[model samples]
Target: MSAGEPGTGVRARPRLTVVSGPSGVGKSTVVAELRRMDPTVFFSVSMTTRNQRPGEIDGAHYHFVDRARFDELAGRGEFLEWAEYAGNCYGTPRQPVLDALASGKPAILEIELQGARQVRVAMPEAQLVMLVPPSWETLVGRLTGRGTEDPEVVRHRLAVAEKELDAQGEFDALVVNTDVKQAAAELLTLMTGTAVRKPWSSS
Candidate 1:
């Protein structure tokens, strides 16, 4: 898909939707569900310097680049938005997302708060959606329950979550992820600009 061409059966220009949240807020799970329900949505696969986790397939899950390559791309301004998280660099490549949108495919980006802000500045037309947990305690429980990180790391993530929650008003919409099915449905409605009412409105 290239810029300026509409995808099959899509007459309008595609929009770029950014999905961001604190770590361990079930963003991945929610996004997975969205993709399962609608495979036509173009989900941008980020390039990351972090090690690949189990069950994560390269090119499908992430680009999985090394630090050197990641730095090279960042230096050359190849990314639409990029940020460092937990010492690892993660970024969305510019060309692919542009191409997807140009081809009239709805593009979704799952990235961090900083990266989301960058996209907001660079692409003002992009829709910014924030996924929030039901509560702080619930967020902590979900993070710890994942068992993927050390206790110290979990603690750090929770701290970050607190800060992220405070920034909820910055997004175009906020969907509380207390129920995965409900939240996913809300997200779908948000992306499609349907009639469903969002829990939090854009400021």
Candidate 2:
């Protein structure tokens, strides 16, 4: 939405919301559930310089690019927010999100904490939601059960997650993801200002 029209006093609706949490906290799963419940919501896809993993599609999961191209885009100020993670750079394209918002669709960004903070500064009206694990033990279990990384890597992730958990107070909404359905219901309530649906859609 554009700024208030000059001398018209017409206010614009805030349309962007950011969701962030520690790694392996099921941010992706929660967001996927939100999309399933509401097909109209526009989720922002991020760009990254990392190699694509199995079952990931470019432009859908992420806009995979080379480091040089990512740097070029960053230098051109085309990104709303950008950050380095695990030696790879990731960023959100500015225009697409604005376009989606301008069309009256709510734009949801699932990003890391650093990028979320950058979005907050750039768009103060954007809502920020923190998705947190139900407990430390649950978080550790989720991280370790992935079987994707070594023990050392899991330990490092847990350390980083501890810091992320402390930043929950900085968010506008805190959703505890003990149950995916319940957590998705809570998140949808925050996004749409509606009561959590009973018998939330499973199809």
Candidate 3:
């Protein structure tokens, strides 16, 4: 039975699902699809010091901030977990997640493996779901297909992907994102209790 099944005499706890995977493994695409499928689900927008890529919205893709501001926030302990990847800083704010959970809403966070580990430390109840590519070659193709970053940045991410894949055992569940629609459907079931029906209602 799921955690919130009725008649179990157990109070339901809001789920904090941390969706993590190697860079370029379609984490954002799968997440965007999840949002499209279920708008009510809350996804934590992380704060980043990296420049926004083309087609990325300031507050949507991430809370893009300057290095100084990011450093200040980190120093002030405003973030739940923070990490520097490929020379850019990324972190999840603590308050919004806590507020979402307090309100009995399922919260989702898309972050790197390191940040996911930190989140695990802070919120042991949080469900860590790892989204993985079908194959290593598939990962390389996805990373190169973006054509957004420098060759060196791509290489660095590729190297990190190796370690990320090796650490998949750390996550509570593994969702292979070979198809965005299918993967998103699986993720929606994890976030909510229901599967992807035609109407897509969480009620």
Could you tell me every candidate's TM-score relative to the true structure?
Answer: 0.82, 0.84, 0.80
Look at candidate 3 and tell me the lDDT of residue 188: 81
For each candidate, the alpha-carbon lDDT, in order, equals 0.84, 0.86, 0.86
Best by TM-score: 2
Q: Which is superior by lDDT, 1 or 3?
A: 3
Give the Cα-based TM-score of candidate 1 against the true structure: 0.82
Q: How do all the candidates rank in terms of lDDT, highest first?
A: 3, 2, 1
Give the better candidate number (2 or 3) by TM-score: 2
Candidate 2 regions with alpha-carbon error over 4 angstroms: 1-14, 194-203
Candidate 2 displacement at residue 18 in angstroms: 0.8
Candidate 2 residue-wise lDDT, 1-30, digit = tens: 234333444433536889999999999999
Which has the better TM-score: candidate 1, or candidate 2? 2
Writing each residue's lDDT as its tens digit, candidate 3 over 75-145 gives 99889899997799999999999998888788899888888999999887788999999999999998998
Q: Show the lowest summed lDDT stretch of 10 residues, model 1.
A: 3-12
Task: Report the lDDT of model 1 for residue 8.
Answer: 34
Query: Candidate 1 — which residues are off by over 4 angstroms?
Result: 1-13, 51-55, 146-150, 194-203
